[model samples]
Structures are given as C-alpha cells and as structure tokens.
Target: MAFLFPLSTFLLPAGGEYGDVRASFDEAKLNAYLAKSVPAVKAPVTIKQFKSNPTYFLTDARTVSIQTAHQVEREYTMLAAIHNYNSRPTTAPEARVPVPQVFVLCEDKEVIGTPFYIMEFLEGRIFTDMSMPGVPLEVRRECWLSAVRALGALSSLDPKDVGLEILIKSLSKVSLAQAAVKDIDTGEPVGEITGWRELIGWYESNLPDERKTGVRIVHGDYKLDNLIFHPTENRVIGILDWELCTLGSPLADLGNLTQPWVFDLADVGTLMVGFKNNPGAEPISLEDLEREYCRVTRQPYPIVEIGFARSWMLFRLSVIMQGIAARRARGQASSEQAHLYASFFNVLGRLARGVLEDEGYLPKSRAKL
Candidate 1:
C-alpha cells in the first residue's frame, strides 16, 4: 500500500482541484438540479468542486455538501444539522460558536444516488495548522479555547430535547472491539509483530467498571481543520462536518482533539485529513488542552483513565482507515490518500497498544500482545 508520494502530498492535491477519488459533478447537471431545487437561484449558476475529500460544490452564493450513507446515515446528519440550527442559543457567551444555516435538503435519486444538503457558506478562515508562521500564538490559543467552548456547548445540550434521540446512540466499547476484529479479518493491514486480537482482548478485560458513560452530543471528528474561525476575530464562527455527530461520550471528542499530540504529523500524516504543521508556532501539550476543555465546560476531570479514551479513539480511527482501504480496494475511494491511510493501519494498532502499555494496562512481559 506504499505510495510513490509522501502522505502529505497524497492528502493535499495541487491547484486546489478535487482529488481523483472524488466524484466530479457535471456543471450542467448541477446547474439543472440547483435551478429546480433552489428556484430562487438564478439561471447559469456557476459550479466549482471543493478540493477536499467529501467533495462539495460552491455555487453562486452557497456551498452544497454531499454525504453518502456508508458509515453514518445521511439522514441522521441532516437531522443533526437542522437540530443544531434550530436549537442554537441566541444569548451571550454560548452563542459564540455558530452553526451554519442549512438551506435545502435534496433526496432526489434522479439528481444523485445519495442525499446532499445545501447551506450558507460561512465566510471565515480555516487554520489547518496551529503552528503556521503568520498565525500568532495568541490566535492559536484563542482557536483552541473556541473549539473547547463549542464542544462544551454541544455537550451541554440534551440530545432528546434537540430531537436527536433517533440520530444519537450510546457507543458500546464491546461493539467497538468486535468491529476492530472484523476489520482485521476483512484485509485491514495490521502489524505481524503485534497481536491485534490479544490487544483487543486486553482492552476488553481492562474495561473501566465505573467509566463515565454519560451520553452527550459528540462531534465524532472535532479538530482544527473541521472548525471555521473568524477571519479577523480569534473566535470560532462555525463548526463543519456534522456527518459523524452523534450522542456519545463527550470524552470521545476530547480524545480526538488530543490525537495530534499522541502521534507526530510526520509519523501519521494527518489522521483526519493531511495538513502540515506550523513550525513557527509553539505546540500546546495535550494536558493543557484537556485542562482548558474541562475548565471551559466546568466538567469534572475524567474519572476514567485517559488511556482508555485514547485507545478507543485510536481504534475508532483504525476502523475508519480500514473503511477507506476497503473503498480504495473497490475503486470507490475519493482521495489519493486512501491507500496511504490504509498503510497506516499497523501504525494505528501499534499506537493503541502503546497507549495501553503506557497506562499499565499491558505488562512489559506481554508487550508483544
């Protein structure tokens, strides 16, 4: 699964064009669909594809993003988006993180095989790297705080009250372990040196008895890239990629944010999406970020061992990588980085094992497991 190009190059395409794995839309077809679906939009609407994976179409005044029902149901994402829009607080501090307005939802099979939603394009800057040269340290800190506050606000809401009961569900650690085993069986490449089955077995055995399993709205993929920051102000204006939003442990999102600190960018590229690190800006420690999140949210520091959450996140990421590999194998992957991601399965597994070992969940004598 090794590629001629590095993971960074594979993930980031040149000239900002959609990557090969993306399904390109014919301009005429998109225009036709938009004309009918959004009558308010005038004729001859221009269409340009976003360079990112999960390709989006930018029309005259709005952006159209599409999602397939492969992992999470597209309908659930749509419902979550609507709920976020409707229930967003209007008052002070909590209103800082704004949800983009979802304008239209199209489910017509004739237009496309899968459902797509159109929403207002929030004008802002997305900092792919927190350490970028021009971005000040203060800005980076604000960005981190903004993300923490956003997650806090999200976790504060009751999923049932927001009409997300059907869309959000409690995640089972057992089910996660089972899925990891299945991924290995299904040609997900893992390390021959490490026993994945043993690792998972150890995880199951060490499951926290009084784990904080409280359900909250979890942003499945919360990271620097997924957030839209205000162009001038050092505040988060919008949060993107709601496809994986669900009712789960708030710690899951927190664990995701801490992933970059766990594995270097050079080692894993970008687990979520590839982006270069800002060499100029000093990096923040995972401990500081976690402390900030707890402070902003006023939630107690996690009682469950941090390693458990880290291991779960790593396992979750491995499953996602396995899916990407399966798609690449079937010629359905949208990004060139799919193969690169597939190649990292072993690395992910090893990292998960390392987390357990560091936390003393696994003994040195049994490290091979």
Candidate 2:
C-alpha cells in the first residue's frame, strides 16, 4: 500500500486513502480514547499513517495510537509519564522524546484482524546515512559522537531496570544458529553450501569462549536510520523502533550498525553512500563513526571481532534475500528489487568468505574425495 499525502498537510484523511488497504486504526475510536485519557488538548487529533512494520498510526501530537486486541503492560512503555501528565525524567522536554513515545495501545485482532502499536510522530528526521547532514564536518563527528553517546546511555541502562532482561532472555535463543549447522527446511543447505560450511566452521573455531558471557541490553536493529537526530543541536533526539529491542551482546548492536546493510560494500556502496548524500547534508565516512563510538564507549576496539561478526551478519542476510528470491521466482513477490536483492546476497557471500579467510577461519584448501 502506497501513502499519498497532501504534500502540504501531512495528515491521514478520515478514511484509508494512502494505498493503505491493510488493517488500519479507527481514528474516531482512537480519538475517543485519547480524549478520555487526557482532557484538554491543544489541537484536534489527526492520525497520520505511520510505520508499516508494526502497522501503526502516528498522530500530530507525537503520540502513538496502537491497534492491539491484547492488553499490553503499560509499564512496558511511557506509562509513568502518561499517568503523571509530565515529561519523561531523562531528557529535556523540548528535546525530542528520548525514546519512541508510545501513547495509546489498541488491538486490531478484532477491529483490523492484526495487532499494531502507535507512537508520537516525531519532529525530527531519520538521516538514513552514516553522517548527519546540514551540519559542518567539524561538527559532523560530534553529531555522531552524541548519537553514539545516547546509544551508550541506553546500553548502560540496567536490563532489569527496564524489565527487558526477562523478556529478551526468553527470546534470545541460539536455535537459529543450531539449525544452520543442520539444514531443516530444505533437505540440505543448497546454493549456500560453501557459505554454510564456512559459517559453521568459524563459529566453532574462531569465536572466543568468553564471548557468550558478555550479553547486555541491545537495540537489536541499531542502524543509523533507526536513530532520529536533531540536525542543528547535533544530538540524537529519540531512538525509534523497539520491536526488535532485546537484551543481547552489545557487539550485536554494534554489528548491526557497523556491518554493511543488505549487502557488503563490494555489493552495494549505496548503504553508507546514501547517508553521505542525504538530502541537504554532507556525507561522512564509516571509519570515523566506528572510531568515535569506540573511544566514547570505552569498549575494546574489537575490530577483528567485528570482522567475524560481519561474516555472520552476511550469512544471516543471505538467508533472508534467498527467501525473497524464492518467493519472487515463484511469483509470490513482483518487485524486480527482490531479484536484485537476492543476487546481492551472492556478493555478500563472497565478502563473507574474504572475512573468514583473513581471520584464518576458512580452510586453506577445500577437502575433496
């Protein structure tokens, strides 16, 4: 479903207008909830069609109107401030909400046949690049520095304090890794035989035994795009998208942000390059970001470890692309991008091999009969 906006007023119409045929929020119903929850409002509630991932509708008030049937624990979000009618305790009120400010939680299992959540429609923009645009280069590094510091602050939060330890611990399973060792869905790991072999070999051979004990609170999908920056202030206003948020190795968070997205650099320069050329912005390099993050976080450089993690990331991404390719090949998906995304996996696979080779995890010679 494609979204059509007024090009002037970024608001959702009374009915579904933006090629949004899927389950959507009932604005009337949501407004009623908000009106009851908070009495004197400054403006009429307007539900803006927001994210597609969790299928939510954002509002002009920067509060989420979630569509869910199940009762969610209000403690999971900004319930404290919502109940108090005050701002969050952590940051400045004018500063973008430090976290995705979730508002009303409604269920769609009955109304829309699926579940969704809503959050405040933030004022800032997602840069979608390695660098902060519209800022000077001297300050460009500081922008990322503050952004990384925010991430570190988030990581520093006690998992128990946030009640994420129990929730994420339940979700953190190595079954996927175990399954990769032995193909389950397919009769065997086909087309990716070498990739699989290399991955399993590296997992067993290279990773330190102490690595598994270092799990911590992770953003799960900690990429530049997931962060919202106040371009002028040069600080991360809010960290968005908590669906994949969990307690895991901090390396996992760093891996997702630093590791190339979709495909490695050889396959697609656009991932990082796109950040540099973000509208009205000057680009920054990946090296600068990584270095600054390490320095500020006081964490080990972990360059070799990051390299190993990159191989793991590529292997995981390949499985996803191949699945899409299979669907496209079967006419399940129509976009040519699906096919192109699939081929890009091949490039990542080659890059993963290079990573493993440099680490000496890959065999010097392939075993033969």
Off by over 4 Å in 1: 1-44, 61-97, 166-193, 202-213, 264-282, 325-339, 365-369
lDDT (10s digit) by residue, model 2, range 256-275: 66554223343465523323
Candidate that scores best on TM-score: 1
Segments of candidate 2 deviating more than 4 angstroms: 1-26, 35-44, 50-97, 129-136, 166-190, 208-213, 260-266, 269-288, 302-304, 334-336, 363-369
Error (Å) of candidate 2 at residue 8 is 9.1
Q: Can you list the residue pairs that collide in candidate 1?
A: 21-334, 131-278
TM-score of each: 0.73, 0.67
